[model samples]
Target: MSAETDLIKLYSQRILALAADIPHLGHLDAPDGSARKRAPLCGSTVTVDLIIADGRISDFAQDVKACALGQAAAAVVGANIIGCTRDQVQTARDQLAAMLKQGGPDPHAPFDGLQVLGPARDYKNRHASILLSLEATLDAFDAATATSASSA
Candidate 1:
């Protein structure tokens, strides 16, 4: 298939709609943890802020400035992140990376919507953008936990 056709398939209406309606958008004030990640190839970026309590995310928000694929991924994360544990986010990230890089299956529930990004697998350069939200989220989680550990 042609690159144009691939692009068209990668940016389906569902992805566009998800990109337009990303939930938990924006930043948090004095969040427990925060992180920002950028995709150098496309200059796409995602910044995440989160609060962790009882080992699960209690609040979350993100500032996304990325391509449709990235935004769509962020939308899925935002919509289902409120009560997720770090392990859940890590597994989702790992599964997504595998799907894009290792010909693995789609990520599981709470993040199954990530399947919309499957068409992006051929575009290796776009993979980082697609994973930006989840990466930043994991970084934020690490930051929060590190702080908690230091204070304890």
Candidate 2:
């Protein structure tokens, strides 16, 4: 198959629709943690802002400047982030990374949305773009987790 075919597969209808309808597309007014990440190869960027309450994501927002794949990933996170914990998000990030980098299994439930981007693994150049959302989310998690850990 041509490389373009793989690219097309990476941007399926679900991905396109998710990209078109990105949720939580804004900055939070009072976030417990926030982070921004950029994909150098594609020039895509994502900034994540969030608040934690009782160890779960209580509020979330994002400013995403990305292609379909990255936007889709952000959409997935935005769609299911409420009530999620740092460990859940981090595990999903690790699973997604393994899926793209080592041909590992898809992430567990909920995060399985990342399965749609599986085809992009062959295009190493796009890896950063596809991972931007998760990376930014994880970075945001770092701040929330640190303070929560000390205070909890």
Candidate 3:
């Protein structure tokens, strides 16, 4: 097989693995909060529901629909961010964006299984889809925190 074909195969296999292992794939339900993000160009959407306690994420889930890249990215995000605090998630978001945009400060260690998406950085159009879940989760966290702060 050609190199392109090999890459495609690898990506497909990785996506499948992620889908299988993701804790919540279709509809994430959490008691504390929910947030949704959409990429109109690709019609990719992800809704993240989070339950935070004691300033740490106690539970999290996601509902996602998109292409293979989007779904895989969502799965990776959902799996990795479950126990993280809001600050950690924000750091991850910054690291991921940097990796995609500048190829700097590789967070591959924290990224864990998501290293498979390294190949996706080369595809500009796919970036939005891959980032959908992360963005939505961050937005949700921010909104939730703000609400909590105001209520307190």
Candidate 4:
């Protein structure tokens, strides 16, 4: 089968449905931190806003624009990030990058849902888009943590 066909298969109905049902898909008023990431490869963009409480993600939101891969990734992140810590998000991001670029194992625990995107590895152009949500989210977390630490 052609790469296009494989790409289509990679984005199964389950993924598409997840994309359509993304949680926290909007802006947050007076968020603790916010960040945006744009994939140069596919013009995919994801902006994240979040609030942290007791070093945990207390609330989160995102605005995403991209193909199904990006949407699905944002869905996974949004769905599971409610109580996540900066370490968890960073770890998930690192594991995802390894999985996509170096054939590493899937992400662990709360982010194991990202395993659904494993097939995306075969499509190099989609990697950045798939990682956009987590990238932006991690950035937001970093900013929030730094601000809190400095103020304390």
Candidate 5:
């Protein structure tokens, strides 16, 4: 098969995997606040709700709809950020973006679960779908933090 075909197949597989794991998809119910994000080009939207306690993420969930890439990306983000602090979430976001932009990184580190998206890097059009969840998650975290700060 051709490289394009291979990439498509990879994306398809990831999407299928996410679909099979339906319970993993959706948003956290954060008592603090919630945030939503979308990729206008692809119509992929993810809304994240999170609960923050003592400056750490106490609970998390998300509601997402879009292509396979977006769904899978959201699942990965939700799974990774559950117990993280705001700083840790920010760091993961930065590191994930950098890894996506600079090709693959050490698979054993911050980019572990996210590395599955490496094949997506070559497909410029799908990049937004892949990153949509991460962006949405960060936005949700920011909103949660802002709300917490104001309430304090």
Candidate 6:
């Protein structure tokens, strides 16, 4: 297939649809933690705000200013993030990275939907944008943990 075809495949109808309907697409008020990350190559940015209770995410929100791939990723995570533990989010992020960078398996269930981005594996420059939402979420989780530690 031609390069144009590859680009078309990367932005399929499903991806566009997901992008159009991202969940939790805003900041939370007085969130327990917040973090922002930018993909320098694409100038894509994602910011995540979350609250943790009993070591699981109790509430989550994100503001995404990125391409369709990034929006789709944020949509998936936001739709499933509630009640998740930090380890679950971290594992999903690591698995998605491996899938994109090392020909590894798709992220486990819940995050397995990220396999829709398989075509993006060949586009190195887009990788960072695609991973932006999860990166911000992880950072937010770390921030929440630190805050709890300091308050203890």
lDDT tens string, model 6, 31-106? 9999999999999999999999999999999999999999998888888889999899999999999999998999
lDDT of 3 by residue, 1-152 (tens): 67798568647777877756666665444447678898878888888888788888787878888778777777777767877887777777777777777775555544555666777676777778878877888888887788788889
What would the per-residue lDDT of candidate 2 be over residues 60-140, giving only the tens digit for each residue? 999999988888888888888888887898899899889999999998877888888888788788788888877888888
Query: Model 4 over residues 1-152: C-alpha lDDT tens digits?
Result: 99788968898988899889999999999999999999997899999999999889999999999799899989999989999988899999999999999999999989898888988888899999999999999899888878888999
Can you give the lDDT of residue 145 in candidate 3? 84
lDDT of 2 at 74: 89
- Tell me which residue pairs clash in candidate 5: 26-62, 26-63, 27-61, 27-62, 27-63, 28-60, 28-61, 28-62, 30-50
**What lDDT score goes with residue 22 in model 3?**
61
Candidate 6 clashes between residue pairs 3 or more apart in a chain or in different chains? none
* Candidate 4 segments whose C-alpha is farther than 4 A from its true place: none
Using TM-score as the measure, the top candidate is 6
By the lDDT metric, which is better: model 4 or model 5? 4
- After superposition on all CA atoms, what RMSD does each candidate show versus the true structure? 0.8, 1.8, 2.5, 1.3, 2.5, 0.7
Candidate 5 residue 12 Cα shift, in angstroms, is 5.4
TM-score between candidate 6 and the true structure: 0.98
lDDT of 4 at 10: 97
**Best candidate (score: lDDT):** 1
- Total backbone clashes of model 6? 0
lDDT of each: 0.95, 0.87, 0.75, 0.92, 0.69, 0.92
Give all TM-scores, in the order shown. Answer: 0.97, 0.91, 0.84, 0.94, 0.83, 0.98
Residue runs of model 6 more than 4 Å from their true location after superposition: none
Error of 6 at 29 (Å): 0.6
Q: How accurate is candidate 4 locally (lDDT)?
A: 0.92
Model 2 residue 75 CA deviation in Å: 0.7
The global Cα lDDT (0 to 1) of model 2 is 0.87
C-alpha positional error of residue 7 in candidate 4 after TM-score superposition, expressed in Å: 2.4
| Per-residue lDDT value at 143 in model 2 | 84
